[model samples]
Target: MNGNRFGRLFQVTTYGESHGEAMGVTVSGCPAGLELSEEDIQGDLDRRKPGQSMITTSRGEPDEVTINSGVQDGYTTGTPIGMVIQNKDARSGKYEPYVTAPRPSHGDFTYSAKFGTRNWGGGGRSSARETVNWVAAGAIAKKILATQDIEVKAHVNQIGDIEAPEVTWEEILEHSEENEVRCAHPETAEEMRDRIDEYQKEGDSIGGSIYFEARGVPRGLGAPRFDSFSARLGQAMMSVPAATSFEFGLGKEARQWTGKDRNEDWEFDENGDPTPVGNKHGGIQGGITTGQPIYGEVTLHAPTSIPKKQTTVDWETGEEKEIQVVGRHDPVLPPRGVPVVESMLQLTILDYMLLAGRINPDRLDGQVGEYQTDYHPRSPDNMKE
Candidate 1:
């Protein structure tokens, strides 16, 4: 009921449930004249839609997004952007058991404890299905960022220990849609898919990792001191329900290195470009973008529902019993999560770009570097080649 909103200047409030009649969002504060339509949002929706592969949930939602407002003649009017996705595959008959008893690793118990009620059908509001709004709102943000030459990408990096080969962001994007798992390496994605299949056959699930990168963003896209860009990213990721673990540039691996090995040293080029020799701090330092690609990773736990029956206590009687959540659920969430991660990146970077004045398509100043936000913390000494 509360806490469904995200963003500052470009805010969004998602409404609806996993089995609700309809789910949608109201996005406010976006600029006018941007090209937009249901078709624009539908492209990313198709990527995040369920029942795509053996690794995803069986629900066959086309996840088609319908634009209800904020656009006329394919351009935004600068008003609230409202869109909705109709629910056509909900089956509430499977939720009878959860009426009084709650499933483990779900919001059933917590919701009842806090609000005196909960929607146990397919986890009600706790379902990852809630991400539909994110993709919708982010689709707009991405369109805005593209004008500034900024690009955000995300891909499955590790699935049940099947790690992808190290590659550039371009390589990652090239390979992202090539495989069903959205990993850049074909061999690794094959192995990952095999592992997911193996677990699905056993009526179980597993966790995996996702990596995202933001490029071409002018420097000074973050607040220093407290509101570091990295912290904002963490907050965005922690919002995902099944997400259990995370790390960024070098993540916990940094713990294994000394200060000298961890510090990103700068090199100066003939053109005064700053080239970083290391990425020990992920991408942010002291709460600011260092004109380097922002790198981040999110770890997602396996879907909580399994066909296998489990034992639990009945809420009304406090008596022991067996219960199995029969909701249509994904075996593993990595493939579907790929688009979700990238969309959030668009939202995150778009906010900073707005603050840094890089998002204005008009370029009213007549040039890119003529604005106040154009100044990044770059010095001749710190310039790297």
Candidate 2:
């Protein structure tokens, strides 16, 4: 498709379909010589890969990545980085019945209408399966951001009606991975897991919001008008399949407060640098970073594929019919989408960093002194040069 690419300087063009032989991405504009390997990309793929847990789709694909180009000696070559993952588990037969019927609240009908044809198998190009490319590219972006001390993280904030409490960054890093749902709070994550189990049993699906947080982001990362930081983030997030809602900073809740309550008072940090006492703005002000942690949320709708029978009109027959979407699908999307959200955030922020000139594209061209080996990418220690 013409729109398969994302970003300008650091562009990623994805190809292949859900049921195709493979899906992969070509990431261009990455600077050369930063340490990279298939394993770096595989870690994020493992998180987004399906069939990982009972709550996700049963489609079993290791989502193993092969770096066919753009690297030499475990470092990038600054050319287009090519990577692929085989669609080993696609069952095209399961979707044959819906080829003409189309699924509700999905791209099936729209894609058919637009293209005069569609890949009915696993929703083809429209499937979340396509997101593997984004995650793979994002893994590289994460490595780039790591050099500049930027860290992106995301967690399931809401699952159906279960909402998590506001948590510190430390808490998120500490407890988010402790449970299947990836909610930061242990108790709430358990509740979410139980609820997902309930939905799995009912053959229904659930949806919820994911909170994205980026720490150590440098200021002035976005252009003033068209390339506003939040706007870019919104576009990246909304491009996600089934993403229905987006909120930045205080988000919807900010509407309830007056100017006095919403304003962040200017103060000084330990270094005597001016900073905001509170971050109601969620980091970006006037389309640029405020040197504060960027926080936002994306809300995804329940998956379109479900065991519950749905009534749809067959395009060829022009007759109404009930169809059961029998295929591997997530009962709840937020948990599985956490990595996707984080990946999108990484790509967005990394692109803006490139655009804003906060980082040099040639920073990774050689032996770089900015690299930190001991601290994890998300650690506060990594934030310090």
Candidate 3:
């Protein structure tokens, strides 16, 4: 319960369970007077909602988000924003059989061991259902970043062994949603879809990676050491269900290169601004944005609730048994995870921008920027006023 919160200035605390009555998020530190509505948040929710495509879980939840508070007359009030999505199609009965034998590669056993109890229905807090809140909060963060011309995008880069070809930002924006797999390449998207269908027939699941890019990010947005932007992004990605690994910019590939090949040389642009000749660092250096596109990838593990029987120990009887997981689950994760990844990046970047004081709080109220003419240092008396 204590670890439900995320971020420093722009914070989000998610609550509820997979089969619980409702799942929701409380977003705090959002600037006041920004335009907001249920529609703005619902658009992203619809993409992440279950049953939208054949490749995803068959559970038919509308996943409609309702704004409970924090906005008045279509604008934010700078208070904690509360939103909820009722779980309509949660089938708890299907999971009754697994109450004794915990599923392999799931949070059931560990959660029960840590908390002395667990929600057997749909893996409770461990379910990908928890990401609903994150997407909702991220939608709002996206709106905040839009004020500064920052945009975050993600696409399915690979599914099992099927990998998508290199795609540009425009291609990702224009074509990612054309298919269920969310790959930018049309042929690759179809192949990924066929692969998912093939695995779904065998009652199996597959995992893949997602590529994330943040464009138009200004410089000076990250702190040093502990709260580095990359560290925050990694922590956010790791918190998602089934997310196994994260790497940004040549990540593991950098291991093969020497220091000279790894270092990106700097040059002056036509505008007299310093720019990197090559973006080997993925647009980040010394824990701050480098005015280049920030890019990364998140690798997800295969969903554990396959239909085939698996060996496990019964928690109550202390006996070994084979259990066939029942109920609907995703055959692949990257497509749905694309929006989730983009949202987490938006949240982290917006929070860092706030902490860095790059964007003025009053900007939310239609004011562009606050300027000062005096250069005199502030004394304790001036600060008090």
Clashing residue pairs found in predicted model 3: none
How would you encode candidate 1's per-residue C-alpha lDDT over 1-385 as one tens digit per residue? 6798987777888998888888899998787667677888898998999888777888878888888898776676668989999988988778878767877677778888888887767778887888988988888888888877888888898988788878788788788899888988888888998999999898888888888888876667788655778788888887877888767788888779898777767897566888677666666777787777788799998778887788777789889888766667888887889888888888888878766766553332235454322222243444657
Runs of candidate 1 exceeding 4 Å displacement:
269-275, 361-385
Q: For residues 1-385, could you state the per-residue lDDT of candidate 2 as single tens digits? A: 5889999889999998999999989999898767789999999999989988989888889999999998876767678899999989888998888888878888888898889997778888998899999999999999999988999888999999999999989988988888889899999998999998998899998889999899999877886788898888999999998899899898999889999888878988998999888888999999989999999899999887889988999979999988888878889888889999999999998888887776677556434556534323533576677
Pick the winner on TM-score between candidates 1 and 2: 2
lDDT of 3 by residue, 191-278 (tens): 8888888889988999999999999998877878887888898999988778889998888998999999999888998989998898
Which residue runs does candidate 3 get wrong by more than 4 Å?
366-385
**What is candidate 1's CA lDDT for residue 339?**
80
How much is 139 displaced in model 1, in angstroms? 1.0
TM-score of 3: 0.94
Once model 3 is optimally superposed onto the true structure by TM-score, how far is the C-alpha of residue 322 displaced, in angstroms? 0.9
Q: How many residue pairs clash in each candidate?
A: 7, 0, 0
List the global CA lDDT of all models.
0.80, 0.88, 0.88
> Distance (Å) between predicted and true CA of 218, model 1?
1.9
| Residue 51 miss distance in model 2 (angstroms) | 1.0
